[model samples]
Target: VSGNYAYVADYANGLVITDVTDPRNPQEVGHIDTAGHANGVYVSGNHAYIADWLNGLVIVDISDPSSPEKIGHFDTDGGTRGIYVSGDYAYVADTSNGLVIIDVSNPNSPEERGHIDTIYACGVYVSGNYAYIADERNGLVIADVSNPSSPEEVGHIDMGDKAWETFVSEGYAYVADQTNGLVIVDISDSENPEEVGHIDTYSALGVYVSGNYAYVANHVEGLAIIDVSNPSSPGEESYIDTDDLAQGVYVSEGYAYIADQTNGLVIVNVSNPSSPEEVGQIDTGDKACGVYVSGNYAYVADTSNGLVIIDVSNPNSPEERGHIDTIYACGVYVSGNYAYVADLGNGLVIIDVSDPSSPEEIGHFDTDGYAQEVYVSGNYAYIADWLNGLVIVDVSDPRDPKLAGHIDTDGWAHGVYVSGDYAYVADWLNGLVIVDVSDPNNPKLAYDMLWMTFYSVFGM
Candidate 1:
């Protein structure tokens, strides 16, 4: 509004002008009708270029701000949605015909100079004579709209394949891309996340990073360990085969703990990673789906028998010390004096494990659907409820655990890992979903800023 006047492109009213010299209490003093809907406008000197959808560019002279005069017009190949004026020409973003350059040097007769065909040209801005196009489906595309007639592609940003399960460690993030396998992304610069490495595996369900290695749970293939010391190129050292389905994994001390559905807790001596052999095993009465090791006890979520606690202090001969019965227990997370069990049918079951010999139920939070996986952080217990999605329970009052919040995910929320203020969820068919849980009572899901706190990756 350098000319003390502002020209607005209105869909209903072709063009509307308002005097801003008075700053406040200024009213619309000029109006003009175009053949088509006025979508966008750009003012330069005394000329106001309007991108009239369907009708192309409609040039108006605002020399006299009170009453605008339509001096020139140009019909484009397709509907124009956005426009930018520079020098003697006006660049219009023609919906499907790409960038259409209209010469407005002669106010009386504006003609189309040239055009570059682009798909779904929704938005465009000219800077340094180059046009930045907001291409739908495709990431930001910078084209040399400088030469509108022969606009050449100057640069482009590539958005890598989508990831479902993500594990962030140190400066890198291990992502599980079902079809593409494991993708290593460099998140040192959160502003610009780039894929540095990737490994092809068959259906990576869960991912965990420990020391210089990355542990990936490969459904049928078992545990696939990769040397991630070099973030750019992760080399697969070896793979350990298990009896049944390997759904989740956790690396602690020098051993790799695997949750083998039918085999219960499968402990592999990862000290010698290249050729890992099963050193110890313990059955949980039923299908053991999830496991967590804290101190001398190994908490197992046995789908049929519920929470099974085993003494892993003796790595060679691990024996069951205690057990807590629950309905269809699928996941277990061991915390101080308590064991959080994700009961698929019942909901979140809290058990008191002050004594390793006997465990008793302390509290419970009845959820909506199948609670498949559980993770404990602070006074809150996050449960991945299969159909109902994420269910957050406040466990500060163990005897009376209350529902803190709940978020319905796009897909079946089978697994979750809480880190910082966001929950990195492994949504079954919906890929990786980052939910903002800074406010436990009111959780949000959208990309913004990230703040660190504790380092915890509890896999499904």
Candidate 2:
């Protein structure tokens, strides 16, 4: 929040600038649809730095609040969760890549200065000569960033709990420790920061310190206000009660197989699309990211669990048949007897699923960008490779699939579906992008339907 405008990194809508001069009646002034999912935002001077998930850091010119424009971007190796802009550099808490410091002196061309790989850096707070990282399960990690080009970890605290975000103020660091709630630490000594106090709250995910109060954004609970006037012992001043956020669904036969994230794979009788009813469910033990239904079997791209095959011969009682773990399965497409998976960072992975009880990896093709979703057509596979856009691969020879062609879309490609000679891509905020795939080796943008409201498009 700066002056009378509030810059929000709205996940679904991108960067939203609101007129908050009237707190009781805040009004949205303008917004810009970013190429990727906006997870966090930091407004500095005339620009707004956005931590865009897979697309990395996106810099927007907000000098005109009502008409924000994308000025620059720097793609990171890992998912960008939070961003903090200080001086001429932007510090990013890149999930897998850890703390990535980018020289954003030139907003139009930001460059990576350096990075420190930690367990899982999610959020970061840079103050004076130190940077505090909320390293998820790794806890609070303190780094000496007196030199942006080569920041080094000076100290760390392992709570064996998930740290989502951090707020540093007056020599003290407040952490939003998910299940562990809010934890206070003394950062006066950068080399030996110690936990000074803590208070359990319902799923604390964000924290902000103002004067003697600490505001926590909790998942299950609403806004929790803690009185941190005394760093050694904090007390809950007040609390209010909150709400929640589907990956993929495949309709076949008379049922629909849904990769329902934490809920796992859900089988719904969708013979009547208008009035679908839940029929069965099976816990995939991990995030159910995508699903492909073929014949009487259901193939699930169970994120961390990899590819999971379920015997859905009876929609009423689906059971696990066999499974093969891949790098990071997120999307699956079954063609003939092969199960093609869009394995996040690992790209395309083809598995022989001729025998449902014993699946075998047969081939794979490493893509240039993050693989999110895939659609198989004829002897070719069209992949929605995040920032790299629509990547076309020839799977004519299942033993060794090769890249055919690709077209960089206007936005991040998250999902794709092929029909006839055109491939419909769910290009995040850019909406539905239609690609001409008449020739597998030479794909082109047929049309970009940017007005449509779609996240993941599918063709029947």
Candidate 3:
């Protein structure tokens, strides 16, 4: 919200600009439907920057509230969640790319100046020369943004629970800690910020500090006002119940590792699926696209961070051991000593994970289309190439993978799984496409299930 016009990110509806000059009754002035899911928005000068969830940063010209126009955009290639515009730059809390600093000096051509990867950057607030990131699970991460080209993490504090949003005022940082409520931190010393006070609230996601009161937005409990006159003993002033605006569940050995998009990697104890409990989790510092558990290690295909290897030997405390950067790793398949990754732009990347601590990309096969999913069977690897359809690669020799066969499907191929002699491909709009891989050299389309909508095709 800026001045008399309120810029709202209305999800699928895009950005909605309303005139709130009359606090009693606001009127919808103008709106622009964005290409992606509009999650967070920030208004600066005559422009309003929107953090469009998959499509990246969208810049809109709000010079005229009656007819807001989109001038330019910058694709962060990740799920952009929160945004904060200051000076000539716009800071974005990108789920997969972390805190992205964009030079919005030219609203018509916003350029990415720099970025720093965090666990799950849900929200961000820039104060002075530091950028405070509300990193879920990883807690609050403070980075020195004086130099946007290469921001550095100078201080960090684990909020115990998920840190969703933060508002800094004076010398204190008030954080909305999910499940744990409002936590106040003393930031007089940026190098070593300490938690000075806290008040529990149910699923707190947003917060705003003004004068002596802090307004908090909670998930289950709605909006709660707290008196922060004394930072040490803050008390809840009043509350009003309101309907608040609000992924992959991978289960292995009584433990479920979820590649939660904006929430990062969440591990739950699903020993009893009926009544599961969250044990521990680690933010992959990017979008946790896919996870493959091989023995004690969990290989996560973090979209922007590539393949992130986590030591899940202890489900209560999963830790990221190593990571190998890739263009955009969305899916991963581990077989024996190797981890095969289906990198979107870079195609297939074969990494040697014999050493979990230091995985190295030994070979790669650039496919004709965008690779989204992969399945390894015996000496062959089946990849779901978006437009180019199903691509078959011979992994008989992991070090030097060769393309064996490829068959274009009716629609976009999103996922693939091989079983017996057939490779099941999940074609986006065209439904299921079964390809006969009995002959790896000359693959044939066995059948096409032209009905159900699918994203991933897997065989049991």
Best by lDDT: 2
lDDT of 3 by residue, 1-460 (tens): 5677778899999999988676446799999999999999988788889999998999998999999899999999679999888899999999867889999888899998998989889888776788878776576688999999999999776545544445556666666666568777664554345668989887665565656776665654545668899998999877644322212334467765666554566665644433456677787887775777879988988887889999999988989899998888888889999999999857899999999999999999989678988889999999998767899999999989999998978556877767667776766544456678899889997776433233554333
Better of 2 and 3 by TM-score: 2
Q: What is the C-alpha lDDT of each candidate?
A: 0.75, 0.77, 0.76
Q: What is the descending TM-score order?
A: 1, 2, 3
Q: What is the lDDT of residue 210 in candidate 2?
A: 60
After TM-score superposition, the amount by which residue 332's alpha carbon in candidate 2 deviates from its true location, in angstroms, is 0.6
- Number of the candidate with higher TM-score, 1 or 2: 1
Q: TM-score, each model?
A: 0.60, 0.51, 0.49
Model 3 worst lDDT window (10 residues): 242-251
By lDDT rank, best first, the candidates go 2, 3, 1
How far does residue 444 in candidate 3 sit from its true spot (Å)?
A: 0.9
Off by over 4 Å in 1: 1-165, 176-179, 186-195, 448-460
In candidate 3, position 268 carries an lDDT of: 59
